[model samples]
Target: MDRPTNPTLIILAFFAIYVIWGSTYLLNKIAVTELPAFMLAGLRFVVAGILILIIAKIMRLHILINWRQFFNTIIAGFLFLSFGNGVVVWALKFVDSGFAALEISAQPLLILLLMRVLQGKKIQLMSVVGVVLGFIGIYLLVSQKEIIRQEGSVLGMFLIFLAMLSWGYGSLFVSKADLPKNYLVNTGYQMLTGGGLMLLFSPIIGEKWTSPVSWSTEVQLSMLLLILFGSIVAFTAFNYLLQVVSPEKVATSTYVNPIIALILGWYFLDEQITLQSIIAAIVLLTGVYFINTRKKLVLFSRFSGKLSENK
Candidate 1:
């Protein structure tokens, strides 16, 4: 039999993903203001990756892996970080941090559809409802003329959507991919490979590199927080949660992250939160709830049926 999980660890992990991951949007927004997007992300993850490896070494953890695992880590790094997150950071230039978070909140819907397309999994009834609500919420959120009319806003939204697709597919891939048994090692490798790729591509696109010493205090602080909390702590928590919990449960972070991002963005960055955006967030998050709850509802109904039969 499997040993029971430590409830405290579970709670702490969830808190990290919920709160820390949420704050990354604001952090990235702050950093990307003064830093080149790919370069900023590349540096953050590379540093975080190196730190994690050093920590693993200090702990005497096995850090070696087979070629297959190495290749898989590279793929995960590309899908989840290099293209998925790096592109999103690039998009943040034209979009509000909160707006980008809200848009990315529809990730579960994309995942569900990808499941159907890739795995031949059938979408349950509740999930179907969720998919519809998710689309409606997205339409409402993106259809606002003022928001999209901003220069580069439309392109940003489109790039964010593409990033979401990469992330959605990455989510499915990682669940089954043969990765390092040590979550820390896995995370470290992914970060290293992903960040390395970003660094490679940063200059190919004509992005001018600047020294970190020239960065403003706020941007410097933001980058530090992102590397420490967002990349190291929160992502480690994320990798741990994936092994312990259902993907749907892991996805519940979606519900809380956008709320935290919205609040932080409004408070710190003076980003506008319109009434329509509020409504869309409600609808969109509700859809995410439905998608996540489907499995639980089924399990509950089956248990109730068993009890009735026993009675």
Candidate 2:
């Protein structure tokens, strides 16, 4: 099927990514409440992975996967999904949901920093500014009186940063890695590797699969929503944008997701949204603009020369 090439589709795709991905934190909170965190996420990926594979089959998508691709995807999956994402579920066991959300929001800063350090990429000027603003925003947002009292959450906040650092670095690897060009195939492999690892870890961590194996309808429904929206729809939208938009533009969704997360946190969990969080929101978006659009901030980026050679 020929994909639609319109401003509308592009805009919708961006929005879907922005809002849907952002709300995933709250979903994790709810799902974790009734279900084991790692196990729940594991089941989610397993279900979503199968569903995506099924859909890919129906669409007859071409998958030119090699053994090396599977291994690469598995490694990428283990790093990005299991460690990057799975850490959130693990940390949430001991932290406030909102605080966890905020910490994860700091990913772009970590990504930019890591890229410069690990990949020898030059830092974009605007992204540098964005990181500054993002930190300021975090400070402001964290001013809620009760949250201020939780020192351990500060530690947990740092842990989530580590999670996102892994996520951001993994994203770079995703861009550079040789794998199936088909998005579904890449995602399927990632889901399997990461999901499988989490399940494996669950047993080691003493994740008892719980007595009365039959799950409640609520758990079943949550699983369905995660598979359909979080896994299938959000990932498809993400991959589609990779083809249609500049990565910088698609990355703006990083900023957009936090707002969605904040709002969803407010709506579903009735979590208090403080005035400081609003101030922080502005700072965060500014940082996001800098982070994703740093190329524009760099005069040298337009030179089209080797950024490394200059450095």
Candidate 3:
């Protein structure tokens, strides 16, 4: 008899992206304390982009392109990487890791709305339900914040919300952009061009890279891990999964990241994760599962196929 097939690699890869990437919000917070925020993130992409470009060339990834594709890549990069991610890093200066997590958790909902507007896909019933439930959950979580006495936290919250929307807009472009054949190579250019643009804009934003700052050995190690694991490895794995999996499945990682961020915030920062937050996280995650898997459930029932959804 033939040996049984296993999904061990898929499972491990899923966990690696889910858990490792999820924990990165706290890591990013720590990283900014030691280094300039935008500059630090800028450096991360600069390095990761170069590595990806080198690897793609060595693998003969065939990234040659026409002018239209070139323009598309830069546009997508500026929107997705520069505006989306740059805003998040900038907001982190005033936002707590948990607060940031709650706000950025809105990306899935934002993406849902964007898809409706951009593609005119009819919003399924459960999707609307899921969106409502997820937002309620996040609203509850934010209410549990203990550090919001000042107006700055409110402003920070607004900024984080903007960051999520920016990122969601970027995702919309990524889905709709007509670009080269290889998505990974496109990601390389996206990171490089967007990150380079961010570097150029850092001074405009008054990001003083040469400003002296305190550093911890742990923070240094964390930055290294983020540049390698979070920026390079996780993103490549993410794009790989995107190629192999459904868009809805890939979207689960967005919801999952906040859970991990919440945990790290509680464990390391001693930021209180209230009973309401715990319940809210569960609600949001449940909503995400429903949003992503409901269509598959309906299809499986119709075809009499057992569910084989992997994300």
Candidate 4:
């Protein structure tokens, strides 16, 4: 029989995913300004992965999986973290944190279209409307002359678009992929493999590595917050919520994350949130809401939920 869940824990879990995950954008923005993007992301995930495994070990949770599960975790890790997240971190060099978050808010729409193309799943009428609005919102957001004219801004936006594709495909893959039974172990493996890959690629792409001891106090604190709260605590809470609450309720992070990110970015980073951007955010998020209106479309898989968090 299933044990009863505490309401307080549920609320706390929701807070972690909602607030902590949203704030990761600002954290990454701060760190990337001073550190090499891949290096920063790689170190963050590798350290977070180690800590998660340690915690799991202390709890005596199963930490070993078959070779197949290990291999699949690597693939999922590459798609979701190495490309989906690492590339986005690189893009942050040119784009505002809030802008990136707003653009990424269209992830559900991408998943819907990917389902049509890859899986031959029919898009429902409401979802079709969502796809249209999502595109319009994207166009509005990207068409701003001042934003696009910035050096490397177009490239950043393009890379972010590619990251969305990777994340969308990763979501579909994880939904059907063979993974470890324990959610914590599954996440640790993905982070470990993904972060390892980034560390390997960082030097090859000519990104300089620096010791963390030399980082500015702000960057150091950002990395610590990212590893501890953004990756581990928020993700654990996400998995906990998945078990206790309805997936749709858990998926509400889709609507809240970008808003939180926008507000935090504006306040802390002094990133501009223009009126046009606001309109675009509304249109884009409304589309996400429609696409997710069907319970069947909710990204209920623990991995996909993590993807939705945009961490």
Candidate 5:
């Protein structure tokens, strides 16, 4: 018998993916202060993947995957981590982080379109409206000055768009592809493959690793936090959510993540939260609520029902 998804567990998973992943942006900023980009990400994935595999072994879970699944998982990993995240990291060298965020926030709409165009899936009207609202909300949240403050080439914007496309397509591929039954095993293999590829490419692009011995205490802690909480915990939840929820709903995390990051900055870094951010949070979360609950809301159906009763 298949196990049912617990609502509480689902909510907790969403929380992990949203809040933890959001905080990772800050963690990455801190880590990259001392560590090289690709090398840092590569080490994070390889270490986390190894640790997760060890835990799975201790639990006596099946770790075997067939050849097809292995290749597919590698492809998925490349698309999501190597291409998706690696490109974003590269683009940040030229593009403003805020502008890059705006581009990545397009994933939900991209996924929704891909689902319809590529897979012939029918989406609800409310879902479309929700996605639009979510996009607008994100625009509102990020400062207008940040969006127009271009210090880089158009190539940076193009790269971020490509990253979002890769990420969206990779997510859809995972949902349909043949992967290991156990989520833990699947996540571990994906990370190992993706991170290994990044490590392979790091030297070719001339990213040399300085010894960590002299690295600051904060940088060391940031890296550890990324490996443990960001990769292992948050990514596992993300993959699991991809399996259980609608891809668009999973993409809704893109909207919630910025909110969490903003709140984290306010509380920990003493950053100021503007009135616009507060309003954007309300609008963005409302859209996510609609995306998740459209079936129950049935606003159109209720309106039509009232019309029939009046007749």
Candidate 6:
């Protein structure tokens, strides 16, 4: 029999990824109220990266890697952070945090597609169903007259879609790429690389901090939270979970994240949650569940059949 999971560890990890990551959307939205998108993201990662590296060193853990591994980490960082996170941060200027979370919840569907297209992974029957349901959910979310009527909303949603795609690709790429054996070390390098790139482009893009020193307490707190909880704690928990649990299970956190994000967004940001969005959240999460759970479901069906035959 498989070893039972430590309930405490599971709870803590789940709390980290589900609640911490979910809150990031709203916190990011708040942070951008005064900070430029690239600058906010760049500083968040750089600080988080340095902090993590320092922690690893203090713990006497290995943090060294060769040049090739460093390069790979940098590429993965740019894909995952610069484009994935950076664009999403920029898009938040137009999209509501709740809506953005709902859209980003589509990451699993995109990841599966990228795997099939790039790595030639076989597409299962339930996978097809999941993809179709995901598309239907997207249509439901975006097809509303209000969203369609507003050009900025449409553009924001499109940008979010691109961000999701970039994130998915980066995730799959990192899974296959060579990096430091320690997940924390690899992640630290990635953050440093991606953050450096963001800082580099910030000036080129004319992203200015209009009132960096005068940022409100809320924005300042939001940025600090993103750096500490979102980047450091949640990400470390996620990476550690990948080593302990099946990635399918890890990915399931995406389903819970949107619900938390919606609640937070509504409560704190006073963001509206429409009926269509509610339906979309259900449909999309259902599709994601189908995609992530299909393997276990197949095994359960086979076990049930054997039990029936024995009876």
Global Cα RMSD, each model: 3.7, 4.5, 5.7, 7.7, 4.4, 3.6
Candidate 3: residue 49 Cα off by (Å): 0.7
What local lDDT score does residue 70 receive in model 6, on the 0 to 100 scale? Answer: 96
Residue pairs of candidate 2 with colliding backbone atoms: 130-287
The deviation in Å at residue 263 for candidate 3 is 1.6
Candidate with the larger lDDT of 3 and 5: 5
Residue-wise C-alpha lDDT for candidate 4, range 148-243, written one tens digit per residue: 888999999999999999999999999999999888999999999999999999999999998889999999899999999999999999999999
Local accuracy of candidate 2 as per-residue lDDT tens digits, 46-158: 76777777788888987557898888888888778788878787776666566576666777777788888888998766777888988887777665666767656665666
TM-score, cand. 2 vs. native:
0.84
The digit string of per-residue lDDT tens for model 1 on 14-125 reads: 9999999999999999998889999999999899999999999999999999999999999999999999999999999999999999999999899999999999999877
- Measured against the true structure, the TM-scores of the candidates, in listed sequence, are 0.90, 0.84, 0.84, 0.93, 0.78, 0.90
Winning model by TM-score: 4
- Per TM-score, what order, best first? 4, 6, 1, 2, 3, 5
lDDT of each: 0.93, 0.76, 0.74, 0.93, 0.76, 0.88
Candidate 1 least-lDDT 10 residues = 292-301
Poorly placed runs, candidate 2 (over 4 Å): 1-12, 141-145, 211-213, 245-249, 294-311
Q: Write the per-residue lDDT of candidate 5 for residues 1-311, one digit (tens) a residue.
A: 65568788789889998888888766765676577778888888888888998989999998988999999989988998888887776775564443345456556667777888889988787777778777777677554454345466366777877888899899899988999888899889888998899999999999988777778999888889999999888877888888777877787786778666666655665555557756766776666555555464467889879999999
TM accuracy, model 1:
0.90
Query: For model 1, which pairs clash?
Result: none
lDDT of candidate 3 at residue 91, scale 0 to 100: 69
Flag the better candidate by TM-score, 1 or 5: 1
| Model 4 misplaced regions, further than 4 Å | 295-311
Clashes of 6: 0
Q: How does candidate 6 score on lDDT? A: 0.88
